[model samples]
Target chain A: MKLKTLVLSPQSRLDEVCSEACRARINDYFEPVWNETGRDYTQEELSERMAEAEVIISSWGSPSLTDEMLQKAVKLRAIGHAAGTVKNLVPKQIFAQGVKVYSAAPRIALSVGEYCLAALLTSLRYLPEFDSAMREGKWKIAGLKGRELTGSTVGIISASSTARAFIKLLAPFQVDVLIYDPYLSEEAAARLNAKRATLEEVMSCPIISVHAPKLPATERMLTRELLALIPDGAVFINSSRGPVVDAQAFMEELQSGRFFAALDVFDKEPLAVDHPIRTLPNVLLSPHIAGASVQGHLALMEEVVEDIIRGLREEKTMYEVNEKMWEVMA
Target chain B: MKLKTLVLSPQSRLDEVCSEACRARINDYFEPVWNETGRDYTQEELSERMAEAEVIISSWGSPSLTDEMLQKAVKLRAIGHAAGTVKNLVPKQIFAQGVKVYSAAPRIALSVGEYCLAALLTSLRYLPEFDSAMREGKWKIAGLKGRELTGSTVGIISASSTARAFIKLLAPFQVDVLIYDPYLSEEAAARLNAKRATLEEVMSCPIISVHAPKLPATERMLTRELLALIPDGAVFINSSRGPVVDAQAFMEELQSGRFFAALDVFDKEPLAVDHPIRTLPNVLLSPHIAGASVQGHLALMEEVVEDIIRGLREEKTMYEVNEKMWEVMA
Candidate 1:
């Protein structure tokens, strides 16, 4: 008999993430328990439901699995996270307990790469400025020349999955890529068709993109000195995480109007409602998106479903985030 | 001795189009005659100067080379135009006179391709919509899910030089390309890595870009029925001459908010300041500046300079327009 599976993603995303086709597939193989209430369940509620479910499909609204909660799921053998980064959702003890875990990080990374490319291209052509000027009934402003991506240098702050995907997307331009990832080897960088460089060297390029993780060692990685090294008319893009950049220092540079920036992540999202960066003519701002998309959820959830089915059949599953890799993985 | 060359472009663009380095090279190779006043020269003024010049460097501000003006330049054997499309500046009589002519058409076409790519990437991620929403202090609105360029089908309405370059730029995405061009054969389309399709079939894609010529046979190629056939949420890009699309049909479709359009040209230039298309939320408007850039002029002029030098040596110039080809060439 097929193992019973319980889905614990945010009820708001249940329909979009797991469409009717997905539900029908689950019914064809295993029974599915879908919570009717659009809320995260308490530990007690999850523990009560654990008695019937041997597998769990978790996402944003699922509570972090604790040691106590792990003991309640006596028959549970697998957990599939239907979103990027299982770091906050899965405890270290789960790996020691032999519970398999999988995440949609790879799929989500591609989406982030697409967003970063969009941001980079948009900044190069001054799309925001043109749109704003057109809306204000202004036409053909002087000094509005645009930069082309071809034959320009692009810098990647770190060797994250999104950065890798982004570099792949830029293959046609044949732009020089400088990567600043201390964890990445020179040979690996070369294999990705990029040159390994110091953070300062990377930031000095005409286009610099931040893709480092939000870790203790990476806090304020882009220092004031490094930020200032960015040449005039250069573009700085930040879509990974907030704290990696010295937000105040970056904002001051943008305010100087010597360069441009497209920021999708910030130190404080929803961006203070009236932040000075919001009014900067050279800045393109988006509320902490760049990672999620409606069509993307379909691919993400399908992968999760595949992982869950593989786990139920005791087959080896791809994308399983093991304990040894937890420290570096987001 | 080198040929005597007279630069007849508007004085406003002299320094920009021909930098000190360019002027130094011109002086080294040719007896360069530069206009002192930063203004367009009158036909009589040009006639007076043409008598002494063996070569002419003309741009936007130069009057059309009528047979009467051509007669005045008794020693002229070459004309290098530092801009796109010499059809307006160089009459058929110039070609018939066997005067070597060169244009920056290929370089300008490349810039247009870059702009088209930027527009496509920007629209895919809904950059304009996000910018407008964020400016209004609306953060993270529902139903704001963006589309990614990967795995999507892109439709090209014609196989112009800009279209060819645009297709090359899209090589990294590995998306399916559908092309519609009566002048193109299936073999030629395959060389561009695109499948040939009917115009209606192409318009039904998630992204459709127009690049047909503005000839009598091609006017209003994007009919009202074809405009209505575009898929919902699809992006329509028109960086080529705008008359190819039925203006009223396009405006109506965009006004309905069923899809998005990024238009760099209009049937009417500067688009009547109070036009309804200007205010439509789904439309991204730019003042007809996509075909050229300030930075690009350096390379363009250098090519023109090279052609003039070659022409003086009686070598076959690569960009010389011939009488047999002028009728079909833009």
Candidate 2:
């Protein structure tokens, strides 16, 4: 008999996340029950669905599997989280109960990596500046000659999954990559085709990207002194969390016009209307969208579904989140 | 003994094109004659330099080697051109005289390829649009989800050096590439890891890039019908010469907002003051800078100098342009 799988995501989100082909695959693998209601499940509804589910498929806006809900889920074997983090969605106690947890963080990491790379290339070539100049009917903008990413040095702040994905994307370009990750060993760095360096050395590169996670230890990791290390004409990109960087120092550095920056995250979302960063010509700002994309969302569902099927078949799954991984995950 | 080489380009240009290390390498290879006048050589000065030089190094603004100048250049065995095209710099008669010609067009092609890839990634991610929206202090602008280059189809119009460079740079992305070059055989397309397709089939791809040369046969190659084949939300890039595309048809297609474009070349550049393309929201315009960068310019000199030295040593040169190649080259 096929395993009983309960999908907590509403039908509208299921339509967006899973293509018809994916839904067909899901039907083939399990006796699936989807939330027909057009919105998130209520606590009573979640408990009712959890009681019969051998596996749970969760995504954004899905109700958390609280202690009371878990008590009712006697048949639960595993959870496939179609989202970046499973921290808020699944309680840690589920692991002691021998429940398997699979996350789609790697899928989101790929999207963030693509965004970081695209931002670097765009900033290095001054695409936005040139587009603005051309819009004003101005050609031959002085001092606007572009720089090639080829044969240059790229610095990455952390050896996070997102950073690894970005490094893989940069393989085609003949660039030297320097990474500063306290957790990464020399052999690991070599495997990634990067040299392990201090934070200062990495920051000094002509192209520096930050991919540090937002842990208590990492908050304000990029201090004023580190931010000041970026040289003139350098391009800085931050697709990671904002609190990991010193916001005031980053703004001051950009205001000085010493370097260019592409910021996808800010200390505050919906950045204030009077914020000075909005008026800075040397920076490219976005609405905290480096990780979310239509393709990414779809891929997340596919990954989780495939992993769920693998777990049911007693096969190795690619994205299983063990208890050890739960502590350091972003 | 070092070979006798006359640099026809001005001192200022030489300084801009060649780095100090490149100059040192050139001095090591050639008993060089520099243009200390800080300007391009006049006809009289050119004739005087040609009388004793065994090799000539030419660049932009350098005087052409006319019949009169060639007659005086009895000792000239080769010409190294530090620019994209040598057609305007060296007369065809020089080839018949057994004088080898080498150009820096391959170097320029690499730069153009880098620019094209950068532009495509920038456009696909809506980097410019997001930046603008954020600059205006707006967040959550509806319908701004990004697309990934991974697992997408890319269409290339030609198999020129620039296009080949671009195809090489796309190795990391798991994208299916299609080519519409009549000159390329199916076997050659396979070697490039791309499928050979007709113009209409190529244009049907969501990511289409035009790299056709400017030739009589290729003029207006992208007709109105072909431009209309592009699907909605597709990205179009044209980094090659502009006259090869039907400008009016392209403009109309872009005006409809069916697709986005990043145009680096124009039929009439320093594009007209009142051209409607200047204000198009779906297009990114650059000032004819797809092939020119500080690193590209410096590499041009280095490549030409290396080829000149190799030729002097009776070795195979990488950038040699023979008579047959000259006929079909852009």
Candidate 3:
């Protein structure tokens, strides 16, 4: 059967990948979203344009597939997300309409995993702040103190795809790796060059990292109790979900100047102008951006293209989402 | 004979390494240049303290050892540099006084090589700026274009110790590397896993890294002609002396937004507050800090300790600078 594809966001790389995949699969593919006149279409215009769209290729900032929007896309059969999270685009009505949902979050996780490894090592080397100090032509300390990954302990807190890829990236570094996951088995951790440990054991390591998903059980997992157990000067990192950590508890540890943290996600993003974390001397803060390097976006686009191709060639869907259980399953 | 040493800086790591080595050898090691009150000392004071000092360990910002100063250190038999660049402390007096010089710049190069590699890859992934944008709480352009080091051409200019170390660091990545050095033989480049190239071939590659030393012949080697040859969106890295790159020429190329640069050095020591390069979007500005990370400093310290150990054993020194010209090379 011929497929009709519509792109909602303007990630140029995404559009190119999806368009190529669609053209290879069918001749009736179409684009319903465009920035003509430098503005997007209104609700009515969107409805008219999406009337024949069989699949939607989406990214961040895409309009939601609400009940009304679904009504207009009567023929829509699938939604392929060319980004990490699909929490915003998949409305309650999407599953009812039997529309398949796919996400490139896993592929994105791999690319981001590499980015995280780079950031982690750079943090250990104290590159950014030093670079900043040097640019100002001021040497805060005439010299620096740093450690190498060799013989160092690095703890990965979750079995998330990105975290898994991070293991592959660290293979050549020869550092000891520990993984903490209630659901993970010792054998699985070993395959990734990691030793499965309890959360307490993981946090107590010299280089503890957070990679847990955002779930009720995982939220604030690094409480004051767990954080207190970490060794002095341990490197704490989070490239996963933000709310998974307790901000106040973390701030307490940070204020002590006992540990170093490399944070890419936080409890509240764009942390407040006067947020205490911003003032910490030893912390490395980056907005919720650990997964959004240009390489990541391009890699994610490749995944979206694969999903679209599978949708056309395979009788079974590639990234079908069960609406009733998404929050729990994801 | 009793071994004598002098510490020329107040660096703790240097002190730790030197003390450990001295303890192992039961030698008399004195720290003569520490800032007791931040005032330069009289020659008589230095002479009195360093009467039997046979070796001097040096680093950045150490007092110059002019011909006049060497007369005070009459028994000085050898000088060990615990840092890169002996240009500041290596006076005609030390060489003329028949003092053999040793340097840890080779050891320090390992860390600098690792740092510049990370920075180069970071630029390829467009990281620092992406993280900066995320800090502002806005995620724009989900990802930019990213290329891997695998199979891509990487050009290295001037085969200094850092350049050689960088080549060693890149070995596992399995990338095609090209090198241009007036002093390097074709056989040497091949042994380094790099194909020797002309200046033209080096500039044409997507990534050009500089490791040229601050010699008269290398000044402004990256002229307008060379900088302009890099393809648009290619990366340019300068971890060596800043004068090697004509700053004015680089500033002009930056305006085109075609080439991205990561500079750990600059033409001027103190970059003016409004230095155009500081504000430029295409460049990563650092205050001459590539070879000065904490690890880099520690590596130098280790090298110095190794030299002291060799001296106590009556073995050949590890980093003798003027070996060909000195009778007491060991």
Cα error, residue A125 of model 3, in Å, equals 4.7
TM-score of each: 0.93, 0.98, 0.73
Q: Please give, for residues B266-289, the per-residue lDDT of candidate 3 as tens digits.
A: 787766666767666787766665
Q: State the lDDT at B258 in candidate 2.
A: 80
| Window of ten residues with lowest summed lDDT in model 2 chain B | B8-17
By DockQ, the better pick of 1 and 2 is 2
- Which of candidates 1 and 3 is the stronger one according to TM-score? 1
Candidate that beats the other on DockQ, 2 or 3, i.e. the better one: 2
Name the runs in model 2 displaced over 4 angstroms: none
User: What lDDT tens digits, residue by residue, belong to model 1 across residues A169-262?
Assistant: 8888879999999989989999999999999899889999999988888999888999989999899899888888888898888889999888
Q: Is the docking of candidate 1 incorrect, acceptable, medium or high quality?
A: medium
- What candidate 1 gets wrong by more than 4 Å, as runs, is A10-12, A19-40, A51-54, A307-318, B19-21, B28-31, B49-54, B72-77, B307-320
lDDT of 2 at A58: 85
Q: If both were scored by lDDT, which would come out higher, candidate 1 or candidate 3?
A: 1
Q: What are the per-residue Cα lDDT tens digits for candidate 3 across A269-321? A: 65665566665667767666566544455455456656666665675644445
How many clashes would you count in candidate 1? 0
Ranking by lDDT: 2, 1, 3
Q: Candidate 2 at A88: error in angstroms?
A: 1.1
User: Which candidate ranks first by TM-score, i.e. highest?
Assistant: 2
Better of 1 and 3 by DockQ: 1
